[model samples]
Target: MASQKPRILQDTRDMSWSLIPLVLLCLIIAGVASQCSFSPGGPSAGPVPTFDIDAGLEYDAKELGFPIRHPEAPEGWQANSGSRSIITGEEGGDSSTVGFITPAGRYVRFTQSDAGEAELVRFVAGESRTATDTREIDGRDWVVYGEEDAEPLWVADFGDVRILIGGSGDEAELTTFATAVGEAQPLEP
Candidate 1:
């Protein structure tokens, strides 16, 4: 008996293997073209700072001095266990939220607002007074405040910036927590 002959279509399969390189070459060319079109340092570069925030604390806002007192918590704000007593300032004119930070990682935050002003003053003054500036760090715009012997606070214009006032700890821990909180991204405003 004669051996069967191979079909033409069947033979094409073996040669198809060679086409793989051609396909890869096309992909490479496309990738290179796309990359070339991208420009570095273009306008609208997101705001970011030029320094490493994770490093030691720097003084800028620190000169402003520490907050005179912890503002009072807003109405309906519940105090966490071990939370210290908060002093509420005048209502309407100044409006304040009072709360305490315990050394045991307990904090009570009260939010109140009247006459259009929210409970923001206490939030801003509760911690170290830092000089704030708009800066671009890692492709994002942050309102960064520099404090002496304290970590800089980076405020994003996202949601209303909330300041972390107290949680019982040494000076170093407080500084670290403030810095970490500053680096976080707030809700988009």
Candidate 2:
């Protein structure tokens, strides 16, 4: 019985050794799965949203009682999300926001809000002060704000409606988006 102990131990060690490769294979599979990103369609987890910027703009225009502007983005620039946002509380109003993936792979959002002048500047540019510089796009005057090194927030108001163009960009990229929004209007479907 005493001598059987060595034989039993040897059998156990052999069994453990046999399982080592299987364990390593399982670990390898886990590692690969962890690194794998399952973006089924595109940016989102599920099927990527094919945001209809024109349709959203049309709806917002009707709802806001104003012609909400939208961009006719160049090739490779796709709209990721587009919706109308309603401001809550006493300052109740609506805004249209469309998130876009720029051709340069940068994110830029075009927001047209019915907020007050101060609120429009504050909401987009945060605490940043408006720059003295300005630009004209498609016959519309746009006021520029934000640091020189960062993406500047451009604002232009038509009566009670305030249009803000901002997001990841330098002056050039910001200008590009502003131009697109100013020049283009969503055609009827």
Candidate 3:
């Protein structure tokens, strides 16, 4: 056993060797980072799904036991989706919903339910929102809820059924869809 160098010096050399793996890891990470690119907006959305409002309304009308109206697709607008959902809370019932993509690429969702106006508003715009104003669309009074926000909800009572329309479009675009839906004849269930 030749006299070994001081334990501290021997340990220092071992420590330096131990750092090699960490250095390599750092270099690998740097290389990966250099090759990585970021998109601030993230991935783009795919095309909207095609939905047939006629068949859906027929089914919903029979199943939901309520009147379901199908608005004629406005120019450059299309029905992208439709579904049936149960309205929860005190006014528990089924609802039929149809989503349209406007000409400007904005979305408007139309929901028809037998639920009361308050429950419909609560379901559509949340409990925190309240009736802000009223908009007359095609001689029909559409109660505006949460109008101060970017997307406001418009609810109209059509006798036994209540219709709620809300979306990302501006007033004009929303009004256009509302008018179409309001003026359209109810589909025979």
Candidate 4:
């Protein structure tokens, strides 16, 4: 005679139906917790409203949502336009917000999006890509890209600080530029 107890596979198959409900319950709890913890406007995650600085570019930090900390602008680079502003994406895609400045009389914008940064580098170098690097800043991951014929360089501006340097160029020059730009403020949730 067969055993009266249900087989393990059969029992698991039967219990599978309840898993959906459990997942839903967890999702609901997460949603509610996020709503309670996030900003009143919605799930906001960047910059505190109370942060203020004399030379700081002011914008809706909630919208930019990139973590930066105590940022300082690069030397000889002044805010040209679009500082601390959200640059909307084409049509209805992901938007990138950045602080814009003119370096060496050239328009350069800084954002938190690595894709956008790569695009910008490609545009400047007139190529698709050659190499890339994973960098850590304030314990967060950032990327560096290089082209085949051009000197290796990458740029990222956290908050107001602008960083642009050749990856393989004079190390002293890169250090100078980095130091001149200074460290940026960490983005807050």
Candidate 5:
């Protein structure tokens, strides 16, 4: 043999070449991470998911065997989410809920169900809440609960059904929504 490289040196050179791709990948990831930014705090503004209120109401009414009211959203209000579920408890029944984003960027949830007042309040608000006051909106009496908190819960009984409206909305926003719900017509099953 004319000249032979040491086996250790040859292995070291091969290992260095194998590490080149991993080094480049690490550098690329660092560059991308350095260019990224995040919000300091608070909720980020983004497109909200849209919910079909009419279709939801129709489906709930037919499936639940109860009238589901279709509230006309206030100007600039958008229905962002909705769902149908059974209220579990001694007074369990079918429940339909729709969440709205108010014009002021606050949230309001409307729940309609055949569940009793206590069950509805517990389900929509919380078990720790208490009835604080009652307000008449659009000729309907709404029992207010947890009014001292940022988001208060309001419930209205309509014979066989109960409607609960609550969320981060203020009194004005809640009133506007309650009025809308009060004026709404039940969807045809």
Candidate 6:
């Protein structure tokens, strides 16, 4: 028992010594993290999170409940985030929402849903809508709705689903997004 006690204590001392380098590495990492350099900016300009478009599509495409297409933006435009969204107060109100950033850095989004045009427009805009004008692109008709004081909205309907694209973007940005959506294909990574 006496010999066993010394052996155990020696083992513990050896293990403690072996952990010294690991502890130092952890301290170095923490110090490096604390000293990280960032540009001068307020919280209003915090880093935006990037989302996996392919993964989000894989998840939302399975539960869209209606046949709809997802768009692939041209270069310089980026898909920001996407997920499956469920709208309450309506039966079978499952929807898919995808946010994007325009080439000029404006934020935009498209909500694909089985809801009616009014419901979808209200959901995307979250305010009263003003139908401005009609624009035809690639043989499809889209109605423009928005306010000068708020983000503009573009609403279009496929045969089975309603698409409401709205964002803090102008008619040109929205038009570009709508064109991509209209020419969308099956999701691919």
- Expressed as tens digits, the lDDT of each residue in 31-81 for candidate 3 is 788964466989776787788888899888777778888887679888899
What TM-score, over all chains together, does every model reach? 0.22, 0.65, 0.75, 0.35, 0.78, 0.70
lDDT of 5 by residue, 13-120 (tens): 688998999998988887788964556896578997899887888888888866789988999999999988888889879899999998888999999999988888
lDDT digits (tens) for residues 1-189 of candidate 1: 647556554576666786888988987898888853445767563332232211211221122122212222333333332222233444222222333343444343322223112223334446535445555544545444545564444343323223433323444443444444345432211
Which residue runs does candidate 5 get wrong by more than 4 Å?
1-43
Candidate 4: stretches off by over 4 Å: 1-60, 68-70, 83-108, 114-127, 132-144, 148-182, 187-189
Q: Which candidate is the best by TM-score?
A: 5
The TM-score between candidate 5 and the true structure equals 0.78
What local distance difference test score does each model get? 0.38, 0.71, 0.83, 0.45, 0.86, 0.75
Clashing pairs in 2: none
Best of the two (1, 4) by TM-score? 4
| Deviating ranges (above 4 Å) for candidate 3 | 1-42
How many steric overlaps are in each model, in order? 27, 0, 0, 11, 0, 0
Per-residue lDDT of model 4, residues 1-189, tens digit only: 776654754776567796989988988898988853445677644432222333343333444434333346556544333334222323111223333333334334333332345454554455666547755544434446655565655565443332344433343344444443445445453
> How high a TM-score does candidate 1 get?
0.22
Using alpha carbons, what is the TM-score of model 3?
A: 0.75
Considering every candidate listed, which one attains the maximal lDDT? Answer: 5
> Model 4 residue 148 lDDT?
57
Model 3's number of clashes is 0
Question: By TM-score, highest first, what's the ranking?
Answer: 5, 3, 6, 2, 4, 1
**Stretches of model 2 off by over 4 angstroms after superposition:** 1-49, 88-92, 148-150, 185-189
Per-model root-mean-square deviation over C-alphas: 19.1, 6.5, 5.7, 17.6, 5.8, 10.1
